[model samples]
Target chain A: MPADLTRRKLIWGGLGAAAAAYAGALGYPVYRYLADPAEEAAELAKVTEMELPEEELPAAGSATILQFGARKAILIRHDDDTMVCFSAVCTHLGCTVAYQADQDRIYCACHGGVYDPRTGQNVSGPPPRPLEEFNVERLDGKVVIRRA
Target chain B: MWRGSMAKSSSAGLSALGARVWNWCDERLALSSIWAIAEKKTVPLHRHTFWYFWGGISLLLFIVQAITGVLLLIYYRPGPEAYDSVRSITYDIQFGWFVRSLHSWAANLMVFAVFVHMFSVAFMKAYRRPREFGWWTGLALMGLVLVFGFSGYLLPWDELSYFATAVGLEIPRSLPGVGALIANIVQGGPEVSTVTVQRFFALHVFVLPLVFMGILGVHLALIMKHGSAVPPSEEARPERERRSIPFFPNFATQDLVMWLICFNVLCVMAFVFPWQLGKPADPLASAPEGIHPEWYFMSQFQVLKVLGEWIPGYLGEILGIGLFTLGGVLWGLLPLYDNTSQSGVRARHATWLALIALIGLLALTIWGYAGL
Candidate 1:
């Protein structure tokens, strides 16, 4: 009886090991295939700087969204002659936030989330964090925006 | 003495050797048990017996698709060269057009067959009690088949394919907060491009087929375990009056005949109306007039369009999507609603619901085409 029990255990254990090996053999290639190829990440990382034509920049107290390496960034020229730039994506849900000149704040129309236009800080609503800030400068009459 | 002499004869020696080999394999494999199971299996016969052929027909069409799809993949590239490769296949390669047309036709036929089979099963109350899981797995298979159609529709990369995909993405894009994000991830960017094509290719060729086969295996196993369902009407009859034929030879033979008929129809369609390819997609050009998705999606497309116009904002789009999703969920939950109550009042409600849903789909589809 002991000999028969040992034989059964050996066979079952061998079968279980084979099944796991089979699963791994099929899984590894599928994982490699489905995973992000990182090419898009590389492209996004490649663009550390974006330049917008100075003429295209919005007037004081207004803002315009700029294409910044697979994302949208807002460039605002305040009434006080101070300029600030931040990602337009809402902190709560990825909706693009727009500057509301009347309220002097950036507003996510999607969920009514509000952010401080000058400091890029979430002020109210569903937003849990501040919008990412970008470095902005005037270079050769172009509004140059760089990752900060 | 006569038996011993016969066993020593030359022909008897060959027969003995064959029997020995069969016995040797049977001792290890137990093959006869499988044969016994097949012999014992039977299919129910009734006025609705014709519907049973449809599920088998869908399987037959899927086999055709698998073969022709593999053949097309040999030359069809999925990225920027997609259009050119398809163009070459249509005009350059020998018999390529035929194979492509066959695959396309088979896909459409398979979807049609699966739908018919599902509705027939619903009306038959085949989802009762023990067979509930079979219905669920079958629904999953149908969903996979629809995705297969959606993904394959975009592979040609023509103007129609490109515009259709863009419009189709709008369904997912209209969802509230992360709608656009979901759409972006699916298309691999803000718009349908080469990356979208590659993503769809991988899905259509690899991921979908693997998942489909897995689900299909379970579905067939469930069918084998439970056997063919008798319609509620037939089940009302006396048990002694009920009749069925063995699955091994009689029903299997009937299934083969149905497959042949299906093949004949498929060939006629493929040859009579070969699939066409429009001009390659131009991303910069304004979308041409009458941009629409495939016929299967027309109902939902029209719903969104009409509803969007009526409500005139995000609210309308959300309402349309919400209603459609609710209908789908209810449809998937039919088995849960009517389990073990084939003759109850709930069964009548289920039947009426199926009828209304079917008519609604047909009407919406027709309305969509007319508006187009």
Candidate 2:
């Protein structure tokens, strides 16, 4: 009986060890495959500053969305000629928020998220957080937006 | 006399050779035992016997889908060429439109049939005792079927499919923490680009089929092990009064006849109303009006939409998903909770739960369409 018990225990131990090894062997490859290579490169490309020419800026009282290091940023020039830049992605579900010139606010059509264009604050609807604001600089013939 | 004797001897010799070959295989494989098991298997005949046919109907449609899908794959290409390839199939290739239409129609019909089969099983209280695994496996299969439909929907790369898939991905993207990561992996990036098409194509054609086939094998094996569950009503009858037909030639024959009818219906739908290919998707273009998902997904879509409007600060969408998940868990675990009160009687609370769920699904689906 003692010998039989030892044999069974050895068998079970071997099986458990084999199972763990097998899981690690399979899981690592899957993890690597699901980790997007492009995402890593995008991370590496993130810089503190992006320069846009004044000619490239949209007409005053309107807005334009641009790519900033794998993320979307919106640039708006109010009627009074003050320039503001904020992340275009809604805090609610990552849907792109659009500047509504008529309402003088940013609106996310996905879930009706509303934000204050001037301050980039969550005003109403399902947005849980305020949009990330960026500092805008006016140089000679250049409009530079710097990440905050 | 000589010619007659020679012909008779030759025929006898052929029979003896055939019998020897059969015996050789039987000794190694025990084929006769399998035949015996089939001969002994039986299906109970009752008023609810008709409900039993829906499972077979779904299986038949799945088979049709497999064949038509393979036919489409012969000409279909994924990625940037996806839209063009499908366009060529629909407009240029011989009988390609029919194959695509059949696959689409079969997918829809199979989903409907599975739903009916599941509800019938629930109402009939077929998910009791030893057959609990059958119910669970069936639910898993249904979930796989939905995934199959969703993934396949995006393969065509048309305007409707692209935008609908984009909207559908919102459900997962709305999730907290790993939501962005999951969405990135699923869509192959931050957006539903050509890469998304390739990923979905792989999922639809290869990954999903492999998993689906494995689960389906288990489900069928379980059905064979337990036979068909006689409804509670049928079970209440005296054993002497109960009637059952052998599965081999009897129940199988009925199943085949139902499949034939289903095939005819599929053919008519595929031929009469061919599936349409819309304009190619433009990522920058605004979503067209009345954009909604497939009918199977309409309920959840409507729930999210209504709740998103009513609640504030992401709480409403969260609540909507939470409630839906809770309901699904309860439904999937029905066999575990509703196992008691056996002996050929319907469980009252379980029935009521199922009825409410059914009514809610129907109402929500209708509301989704109406609002659209």
Candidate 3:
């Protein structure tokens, strides 16, 4: 009877040791994810309600970079003097492609991927699709991207 | 004579049905003793050194990762849409967070175990002689696994992933002529884009898994062919006359026990901390304060600092990258390196120490990444 109890105890002990070693191995990545930045953004994006503004248009020949809500936007004045909004995320790896005024094209420094500012087309490089476009309207002088 | 021939034909007919029809011939059939075969194949009764347990433990971790990783995939979204999907998973699914964390942790353990196993194999000069290919195979698998880690690191679409990937892409950019080209392909054009996440997600969850599985299959098959090394003992045989258990029932039972224990630990981790979803990767937002490579690559990250992007020109850089690869190939073809006999306990111990030192240095490089 004593031997049987000892054997049972041994089996459970072995089981416990194995479980602990396995958990110990997983320490680092868990620490990394807990401290990630994305969690912060999720907190920031939550809104009860936000009243967007109205403004006079910046002009037809140039573009403006906007950070509204959690999204980045490139608001361009088209040939018609109307504002068009598009997500600044490069159609490629999701890098924020910036408008280079000198070149009149959006360029991603990460991989040298370039896209057309007007059409959001992949002019040169590895973009599988064009930049995602969003509709914008001028209520007064201010511009609001239709998120809803 | 006619009656005996008829009897043999009838038995052959029974075997044709695929059931154990031969059992009916029990009366006259020549019965070879399967028990005798088992006896001949049995491992000698001997206990393994504790170090020997490391490889079994590593195998245990690998199996754990496979199970956990598969479960995590059901909730993982590997595209521009990854962040939202992961959120929904945490809130909507029962035990979603638990599963994800378990998967994440299991992957971490697997990488740790594989490295430990790898170093063990190297030190014991277990890669020597007929098993050199086995050694090389393990090494190549190690490379594939790191790639697995790097690619998967970006899948969660969190801020850390965003920054880590930005750093990760720079390694290829340091390559030379093809560096830019490779970086573009990896990024799915330019910058950290959704496709980059998608591509890495595919590689992490699908492609690398396939390749790793293939190499692993080959690795175990070769280990079986070559046999495992028995650790050095006070009552030891000369290396030349050393023998091993046939790697089946002898080691398999322990592997099972190790796996069960590892799984239980993983469960505890899942419940305690759960997998935390990071801030959604926002391109416009700058990276958080301090960013580091995933643990498995910490050593290599340290190397990059010391080595400082020394790929030379495009060709030279390619060569630099190729050197380790070349070493792997050379290591794999061990049977060819010296088919000659290496006999003695001293030689075995020396080989073991050499392999351990090499692996230890590599791990140190990772450990020192922060310093660099």
Candidate 4:
């Protein structure tokens, strides 16, 4: 090949090779970065259970907040010895709901959203859906809250 | 004789198959003509040729933003969960931190690249005559990109973004007639709430991207139609003295090299200085001290602050907003104001004006950072 043609080939070839190498180096991490997080699958199978002594439970008609991993749950005890728990995050906007003993409903201060404590149903507010209910079991003198 | 005949028959069969494929494609599309045009394309080489890469850099950053933004969307939840979800993505999700950081860093760099591209084009006076529409589209893209930055800033739902957005939304209220209306639309109500966040999220993810893609298509088409503008100085030279290079392999290779360098820089920045979440937003709390908008908005923010101090009340805000709007209008109509034919003494006034504006912005940015 002529000198000029050979020089052009070398320059173009080098650029092409360098570009490919750079892309490969950067693209691998980018592909991994864009992939679905492994935690999503792990979370699908995650089940968390926390037990509190029966004495720690709030009195009848009252409720207390429980920490579950990075989430919060409100535990309400009834006069009939039945206990109920619901995720504290309001369905409308995810604000932490507080149990109002006098009104006997869970209330979100952010937007006047209300949910029935017993059923976790949207009572009368901007909330579009009921608060999420958690499984509660009373065993061995303790209340166990199971979250999936 | 039989073996030779069989070989000839198979070769003819292969040729027939290729012809059929070509005919099938040709029936639906005219790829040959497109290729011919592409082969004929050339980019002028001159002293200011390096500046041309900024447009490509901006486009690359935008692609990065789009990809990373989509990745972030998978884990991001709007509304009150936004803050925690962002935190979870940063801390819990695997490689989420890297993706989120890359997205944020690329967004900032994209804005920077766009500004540089705009300024470079302005100085080159490339917006003359037939390129006026191109200039308008470019200006529109700049506005869209700023909107992109503003909307994306609020997605993290962190303290800085939250307060900054609140202030940003307030600026529209300074418009004379429909000011409050615009602000209301942006906020989705009288106050910034879940609705505001949702509205911003929609604008950032769906609405803006579609609009940007449309405008970008037009912009690229216009660039190809008119080819790259030769700097006025180069245009002034005799035809024999002006040199050119083919777009393929030559200019394209150089563009690829610059892109690689930019990619490396982005990676280093994303990894070295991962974007911080700041503090989670507290709606009930007052705006914190030293709270300001993103760096791109710093100059305007500083102007508002100084104006507020000097003039007092809504008057100052109105004046500041009015001035900013006027500047934007003038910038969008730059081609109309500058009718110069080429660069040199003739272009000095426009060039000096651009320089002064740049210096003024830099000074304001520094002053804003100094909290004065």
User: For this target, which candidate reaches the highest TM-score against the unseen true structure?
Assistant: 4
DockQ (C-alpha) of model 2? 0.01
TM-scores of all predicted structures? 0.69, 0.69, 0.58, 0.74
lDDT of 1 by residue, A22-138 (tens): 667535533432332354555686798988887898998898888788788999999986889999999898999999989989999999999999899999999999999999998
| Candidate 4 lDDT over residue span A1-148, tens digit each | 6656787799999988987997787677667655555545456436488899978999987889987655788998877768899999999888999998887778999999999889999999999999888899989888889874
lDDT of 1 by residue, B58-114 (tens): 999888888889878877999999999999877766566777898899999998899
Q: Lowest-lDDT window of 10 residues in candidate 4 chain B?
A: B337-346
Per-residue C-alpha lDDT of model 3 across residues B99-126, encoded as one tens digit per residue? 5777678778778777777766555556
Q: Which residue ranges in model 2 land beyond 4 Å of their true spot?
A: A1-148, B1-6, B9-17, B341-346
Scanning candidate 2 chain A in windows of ten residues, the lowest lDDT window is A29-38
TM-score of the first chain in candidate 2 relative to the native first chain: 0.83
Q: Report the error of model 3 at residue B320, Å.
A: 8.3
lDDT of 4 by residue, B1-372 (tens): 656665879887667778989889977898778878888999999889999999999999999999899889988999878889999889877678888999999999999999999999988888887898989999999999999999989888888888888899889887779989999988889877767788899999999999999999999999999998887788889999998899987999899889878977998998999988988887888988778788999999999999999999989999998888887787777777676675545477677877877888899999999983
State candidate 1's TM-score.
0.69
Q: Where does candidate 4 stray beyond 4 Å?
A: A1-27, A30-148, B1-27, B340-346
